[model samples]
Target: MTPSTTHAQHPVGSGFTPASTVDDVLEGIDLTGKNVIITGGHSGLGLVATRALAKAGARVTIGSRDTDRAEQAVSGIGDVEVRQLDLLQPDSIDAFVARYLDSGRPLHILINNAGFPGLGGIVRDARGYEAQFAANHLGHFQLTLGLYPALRAAGGARVVTTTSGAQRVSDILWDDPHFTTGRYDPGLAYPQSKTANVLFTVELDRRWAADGIRAYAPHPGIVPATAFNRSVGEEAQRAMGLIDASGEPVIDPDRGKKTPEQGAATIVFAATSPLLADIGGVYLNNSDISPLDEDPRPVDLTDPDTEVPVDVVPHSIDPRSARRLWELSERLIKSPSA
Candidate 1:
């Protein structure tokens, strides 16, 4: 299980398929007394996962930028609460972590589910870092580090980060992650951040596995109903076959388009599955570990017939790059202008 050896990238044949819903993966699992925190748990797949986890008896806490909206969204969902967390703001992330830790509760699961697609144009946080990279990767990095004590206190914890199939398309733009030097492309920025998510998982597992805390990155298949896809605009979505001529969502699990429930299956599976009790640092898709696919073919979004490659690529799972990313993230979060 050395870092260079694929990090157990092969599938374990979990007996689940792309069509499996959240309920399917959580069939007999009981999460009594478990304390979980999910970012962006008020909407889209996050909302679906929050309801399902709460139904399974886990006390779920949601981190959202708007507490009022979050509370309203989770209304009637038992054993769930919401707190303010703006991932693009470093102070906000720290404050959220502090509030949770002060409660003296052990964190059984942490889902880094919130993300920014960087759809229309370039947006930067106060630190001038790219918004997608800042929020999706660095913000979660800080929160996880802040919650280290609570995770260790739980004795065994799992951290699941919601990545995307887009990770296959790009690695880190090592020279200029924030688009400081080159022309900004939203397409490249989003994929770079998603790739960071998987690399972060790989490095986190390597550093924390001995502490009884394991990490996973789940590529919840494309769900057109999510705000992520909606931000792409209806015309573009239809062009990509995510929606039909009449604008209804295209539901094809085998081809990666899925309902919200189906999209969340792998997320909760990574969080609670006993099947992965011995595995960590791998990318998951369709409710199972994804096999390594190193093919260099570029993704084609315009062709509806071409299937997007979502498997783990070498750049996203490379041990050396993972370690380097960990160090780079540490530096970026510490510096005021980074």
Candidate 2:
């Protein structure tokens, strides 16, 4: 896994096919003695992800904004440690790190899995920043850097950030990030945040690869019936055709769309798959490296180019853009800690 060593661009064939569930991906992979942390591991895809990793014998720590929810979710999910953490609050991030540090456990994996979609209306943090951008991008940025030491200590841990196809909508609006001058648009805001996710991974992988800290950002495909979709109301759901006339979601909770187990497969793959031992800074779907221009347009709406033709979507994995985005994000977040 030398930083300069590059593997062929061909897709890494996964044993667990497209229809594979999280458990399928981790069937015989024993993760005993490994310490893993997953943000937003209490609900939706996060919960499913936690279950898979934990079942594989990994010591999982579920970090959440809500302590009660975290406790409830982890209660029967194998041997899991629940810690109260809010990516939005720097102090909470600091506290979570301190507690983990005090425990003297070497962190082996970090999955930045939480995200928010700006749907209902324009919401801002107390700092007057748009909530989606702050929560989805800034929050995880802060948390990752804060936990860098633990990741470094493990020497070869992987950092998997949850990215979305929505990234095609827009890159960060650097000059008007807060939407101060123009009207606030939820649609644009969500896509912008997702784009940041991809760029963040690109930058992080570029810089950290030298130190054995490879980063991956993955498009976990669509979750039309999870907490991730809860933010979008009836109108947005209808527009996406995810809901029915009665206001009930058209997709079944368990079998329809991707089940939570299936939704978490790629995330699990990206985090622990040996297939990616030499892969860094790439965008993945269904455990395979994807084409950089499959979609052509940043947010192309015309039939999406299904490069691999699976539930997972394709994405750009440009190294140069990743480097540039990394620099820009460092400047923007500008945390003294980073």
Candidate closest to the true structure, highest TM-score? 1
Q: lDDT, candidate 2, residue 262?
A: 69
User: Each model's number of backbone clashes?
Assistant: 0, 1
lDDT by residue (1-338, candidate 1, tens digit) is: 44346468889999999999999999999999999999999999999999999999999999999999999999999899999999999999999999999999999999999998787779999999999999999999999999999999999999999999888778999999999999998888999999999999999999999999999999999999898898889988988888999999999999999999999999999999999999998899999999988565776666768888788888899888899999999999999554
Report the error of model 1 at residue 131, Å: 0.2
C-alpha positional error of residue 297 in candidate 2 after TM-score superposition, expressed in Å: 4.6
Alpha-carbon lDDT, every model: 0.93, 0.74
TM-score of each: 0.97, 0.85
Q: Write the per-residue lDDT of candidate 2 for residues 1-338, one digit (tens) a residue.
A: 32123422356677555466788778779999899999998888888898888888999998888889789877988889889887666678779989988887878899999877666778876556788887888778877887888888897989999987667666677667768889887778987787778777877877888878988877776666687675767777766656767776554322224556766888998898888998877767666665454434333334323222222123334455556666765665664222
Model 1 — TM-score against the truth?
0.97
Error of 1 at 250 (Å): 0.4
Candidate 2 yields a Cα-based lDDT of 0.74
